[model samples]
Target: MERPIDFSRDRRMLCGICAHQWLVDLEWIDRWEQSREVCPGCGTTCEHENAPRVTVDPDDLALDDDKIAQLAWYHTSTLPDWPTRDFDPAADLTPETRRMMGGSKRVAAWAARQRGKALHVGTYESAIHNMLRRMRDQADHGSQFYLYRVLLMPSVVVREGWLIDPGNFVGDVVLDEVCPPGVDVARYLNYHEDPGGLSLALGRGAVAGVQQVAVPLRDACNNDWVREAVADLDGASDALVPATGRLGRFMRPSSPRAFLGRELGAALAGKLPVNLQDQFASAAAFDEGDNPMRWARRTSCLFDLIVVPLRALAELDRQERRTV
Candidate 1:
């Protein structure tokens, strides 16, 4: 059994030069104060005295069954028939079929291999981001998208180290365990080969009963506004440095889809100014009224199952027609 470390005591440190952030235990910070340490992000020797440090409060790190029940979680997909409530990671795919799967299916299989069998869900923003990402990558010209609002059972056991600073949690690595001596870290640490840690919770029954409601967005991928925004973002991202050699088969170490989703989400939220802001205006308004963020914020934990009424679905279709 792994020993539980108190995350409330962890201190978040940021590297001034690279802007890389990481979480370290109190002991690690104490040692760093005595002697400067090498930054994992940029390999620069950072002086502890000048580095930014913030200790996490106990309340901020608190997660329990009650808290899990209170918050809404979500998952998004382009596949209309994709399983929502009872997710079997291995499902119908065999080893051969798993290898043959492409796009999100392939990613899902890979996640199951890395993180074991559990339904993956996150905050409302994450769900919207995921939907946009799928539309940008996998959706057809007339493809629709589904947004699922997931309700976790009050008895759900959420894994620790995931709720706060998830990027650091996911990116945490032991060089010796993952990379062989004299081998390039980039070669092994890219998306395809990295050993993920989510299995620590998923494989242990962290999720029990789950209920979900699917909201269909018709012709979402075909919306002219969405197309313009996606095109603009894709062009910008493609100009960045590309991965080389064998690793090119996978993807960038930095997950570009997530980055694009965040950028697009921010743009939609009016938090960022983009060249296509005018084009995205109508879509942004539609998003504001009928989005995962709004739904997640409005509902309470009392409802065991929530479904969108037919009138609401009609309203969504009407909204889409107006936006388009």
Candidate 2:
């Protein structure tokens, strides 16, 4: 089990040279309260001005059963005829589509189980948080998206090369945040509305040639129904990233006949890379009522599940390097 750490009782500091920001544990709070601390990214005794006061704690993290239900509903939208309830066996699932969902119904079943529980908000939050950690652990072994892609389409990702692109062959893309490494999912989910933390958890580096694009919800199509469904199974709250109405809008109302589907086709056809930053820009331009930053956060969380495999890959690389 992963131990819970205190995010509060700390100050966040930024390295001016590397633009790397990190949290300084409370142990150093008084020692450096009057001065700056050495940065991990770039070794420098950052000045006091470079550090800012911020608070992050378990109380800050929120995930509940209702949001989980809505997310599960979104996942149901990804399927053609799956029952959109708390739990589904997917008995109606077609073999062709089943293969696309990584050939495992465990994730869907897991979501159902989570939803079925009558746990308190904190309980749900802690459960989901731990699940995310476990998912991260599994990703390191290349068991996430890479494994599924290989099983379904063996010739997609390049076996070996300096220029590694995960979605090169079919736009084989995965949804990811545009925010730099070190920004915690909480910060992003919260839209960085707070004063900002002193320290950020560094991001696992992305693969070379792998592009992080954000497709506007209006332009995004449900290419792989199963993949989208699976993603929805482990979704966060729309309220957490309150910008757009709901994260589901980005890929719902299946576009089986739209010309737009040609570009954003199912996970298998992966073609065009959506520019998330630009998509948010355009949405903000016309969404006279919604907050663009909030919309970005919602969008980020909506697609957060899609990047697990990539994150796993990054973690594995970090581990291998440590051993070397």
Candidate 3:
């Protein structure tokens, strides 16, 4: 079977007339070689060579050299070769990491300043959770190790945004037959229950011949997904909350009272007080207890912050639909 085109990762040809880059999705390259496709950017029908614009490479969109140098400084200043080390919980952040972190806090703010678009690029935590979920869907048909990793690692990542290809990232084997009827999708979606089955499905994929490749943590900040987002914003604005703890800090209330309305906060917090003083006065205070509900509320707050801005953007589309 032919590989499907990934709009996010695949390169697209640039049209000479309008300078718009478009992916070739529906037809074969050989067929395209014989007959050109229409340029989506401009209504120009031209051969690939006559188009005058080359495909845009995702790698070129990586973080600029200065940003990379900054990360390198952080990496070298703290550890001799921090980029090579696997993420470890017991490790301490070097001054460089702290500085990189400070920069991350500005992503959302910067994103907001963009002219007409707003996006929540999300923290590494969200990315990792997304990856784990992806792994649950794609990993070997029955790997116990992968199962525990998916279940336990949601809250444990030291950093995130490492580029791991979801397609080739894991799997010793596909155990489609081993999965009970109707149980496959449910296992991962409703993972709070029997994730073991998902793990079991993934276990076969963890075999010796299977290899999982991951882009370095240092490059996580430079991933194509983020760079493309920034580019699409067209210098409008942006901010970043690099981690969940800082995400909580960014959502913290300024005054003694809870900004999130007493009732809503109380409800989200379960029986716990909805006071900002307790929840976001400081990092230490918020991390004080292992109360799962407290963590859930924090996660919910972050999720809401990530989504509320997009509501207006969605509204714009709705208005356009009505006009059309």
Candidate 4:
């Protein structure tokens, strides 16, 4: 005899338009999947069949040990060479030093300002989205991009809380305590926006080492689905006339966030959870300019951080390739 379906168990649901997560019964999920459901927090229609289901409690978005261990994290780089040695934030701050080292000052400065010493990594979609951003922003058509699969140490500690939200500050008080006598608090906060940097600087000891084998740009772009979505986004973007009025700008047809949201949502439709796809789209629409941290936070909160020491990373066979 076949086992009966259990509709009593709680199923977690996340709203893509807003980052709100909630719980429902399996029966409700079954019905919602077939039809449409409205998110309580944002009132947006949640109709995607593959909506993100939180594995943990909705109230506590933290990742447990098992979940962290099971998930695979990704990092992307535009360097001409493969197999990056290490991450260094200090050298990134100096424009002359960055130029001398032949690094993309934009990427370095972004990492230094946002992630600090901790390297910025995310889910496959986020990694590819970042690569696309670099390509569009820098106009570096000749550059090659590579994707690395990151492995974290088993014992690495994962922390919770949004890096940018003041309410979610992770207890580093050095900035508040050491503020200069007359410096404006806003300015000081702006200058020291790198929470990951501060965490690393404070000796938090989180580490993530990439797998030796890297996925080159051609392989990623060659995927039929990715190519089509990118082409659609490019076509849409090119067709739009620059917005001049408040109404036109408010619609944001020209915004990078909107463009990326539409692109990524379409590109990773079945591959990612509906909520995550929505989150990517929503974040792109709502986040300031093209700030990747907004979506990165969404991805990180769902997957949690992976920490692996360089010594702990094992070499993988080049013949093995993971599809995005």
Candidate 5:
């Protein structure tokens, strides 16, 4: 079993430098939620500040039963047919993408390797946080549009590289406060709003566009009906960096769609769609004002039974382990 350690136990978080030195039992996650943990050294607010948090452990999961039933109802009734997809860590990704996925945290990577040997599974946050450990590489890999393009964002970037400078890809991209190292990203994303109203940041003192592009995702498209159910599952998988809105749960209606287009028809709102408003109207439907997140408790139950055990990452061989 993975032992829970206090976040600030050894690491002293320096606000100005964004660097952390390991200490003991600091458990500073909640401290960041209330306010930014300042550095004892130079006293500048960090652009990024966070305490790592992972998926609720199965033993520690908090969902109830009724909500699980609702998720099942949506699966049987509302979800559109989809197909199966598979997760392959060895799959070639852009240099930047791997960086976002924490392709290089020695500790986290070591944990992953151990899992393969022991057939152990990782909580989603555990897998991704470890990948993002390379804070210094952000700029060399990408910038603001990188934040916009969650699709290709790198997991690891240098403090200087955090935001791609304003230029070819987009505009000046940077971090409002650099959380440097020892900052917890999961806790940060869940805690305070992005600096200056920017939900995502970039290079030092720079960022790309104000309008962030969201991806199109819905219950019908998910549920993996198009392919083998779990094969195509993206929401909760450690390998795939989940898009926004994971506070609820992954892979369900709780997560917002990429845009407020087809589903919530502009026809009802009286705004006309420039292209194929009719078609989009036919497609986008809230169905009911049911917050899918409420069903997360229930969906989690079914998912634990269906998806969790089937993940084969723990079964990788020595060669595969080395590659990951």
Candidate 6:
């Protein structure tokens, strides 16, 4: 049609993952052909229908000064060449923000205390993943509110205020008939190139493959461990004899459990004597923030730690059994 864009206005890019608006080169649209669109930096393919086309006059609310400062610090640290963080609308922090930033680098200091270290904001891909929080969702659809993760990677987190985008910068969501029916709604993902026109089908194949191996392994670990615990409990007098032997062998395309796979199997095989000893002690041993061992019950951690290993071992064993 009419190029679906307005040439008279300034250009900006709103990353669905980081939610940070970076300036777009107006010359880009002029340079590229009418038939296609792709990210200027990465050869990542963005289809014709997916580019932002509309802009309106700015009626932005009073910007949050502290948030703007952090954005500046992030720019200085991550993408040094990007524009500085000072709000175009204002020269300095709001009076209330001056109180929050404490006349010095309060935001940065506070961030270090909370996160222990400044988050190492690196490549665009990593930034996108850290913000969205959601891994590639395979079965989600038709969600109006897309969660784009904004990781405050800079050494400062504004505790007393929130980022305000009063102007409500507008962009277009490019969707086309070529995209496949089911697409993961993870904002950070710049939808993949699928044959059937499913625009956001990127990395779904890997997610699917992991699930296939993880599912059976997770189930078998839980089942096998529970069987042992129950048998022990039922006959308190007898030593815990597992109702079934270990997951004999599992075959997987890749080793998903390189770090904890063998260790988990060894733990499960050894007798911990009482159910009082958490079956998931192994997972807890490596617990960090969002400790799955603590948050998820012992049954779950046990299952999580054991699944990949058990799946690989079990798969191998199954094929061997078939041979016999």
Local accuracy of candidate 2 as per-residue lDDT tens digits, 1-324: 111222223445545566776676544543454455455675555364543333333233223212221221011011222222334446567777677765666647644543432111112122222223333332321112211000011111211111112222321122232222332111112112112211111111211111112112223323444344334422422232322466665743332222222222233212112212222222222122233333334333323323322432233233311100
lDDT of 2 at 6: 25
The per-candidate count of clashes, in order, stands at 0, 16, 34, 5, 71, 18
Residue-level lDDT tens digits of model 4 in 59-119: 3211333444335555557752223344454543677766665778665565554332233
Cα lDDT computed for each candidate against the true fold: 0.38, 0.28, 0.27, 0.39, 0.25, 0.27
- Model 5 regions more than 4 Å off: 1-20, 23-27, 33-36, 47-324
What is the per-residue lDDT of model 3 for residues 186-215, given as tens digits with 9 covering 90 to 100?
012111111101112222111111111121
- What 10-residue stretch in candidate 3 is worst by lDDT? 69-78
Q: Write the per-residue lDDT of candidate 5 for residues 283-323, one digit (tens) a residue.
A: 32322332334222222222222233222122111111111
Tens-place lDDT per residue, model 1, 1-324, is: 111222123445667667777786645654555666566787665354445443233343123334554554445565544443345555666677666676566768575554432334443333443443343443321244555444444554433333222223344443333323432111111111101111111222333333333444332223444555546544443333456688785865433433454455544435222212232222232221133333222221101111223322243334321100
For residue 230, what is the lDDT in candidate 6?
A: 38
Candidate 5 lowest-lDDT run of ten: 70-79
**TM-scores of the candidates in the order shown:** 0.35, 0.19, 0.19, 0.36, 0.20, 0.18
**Residue 116 of candidate 2: its Cα lDDT?**
36
For model 1, how many clashes? 0
lDDT for model 1 comes to 0.38
Show where candidate 6 strays beyond 4 Å.
Answer: 1-105, 112-222, 234-324
- Using lDDT as the measure, the top candidate is 4
Model 3 RMSD in angstroms = 24.7
Runs in model 1 lying further than 4 Å from the true structure: 1-13, 16-66, 79-117, 139-142, 163-324
RMSD of each: 15.8, 21.6, 24.7, 14.2, 20.5, 23.1
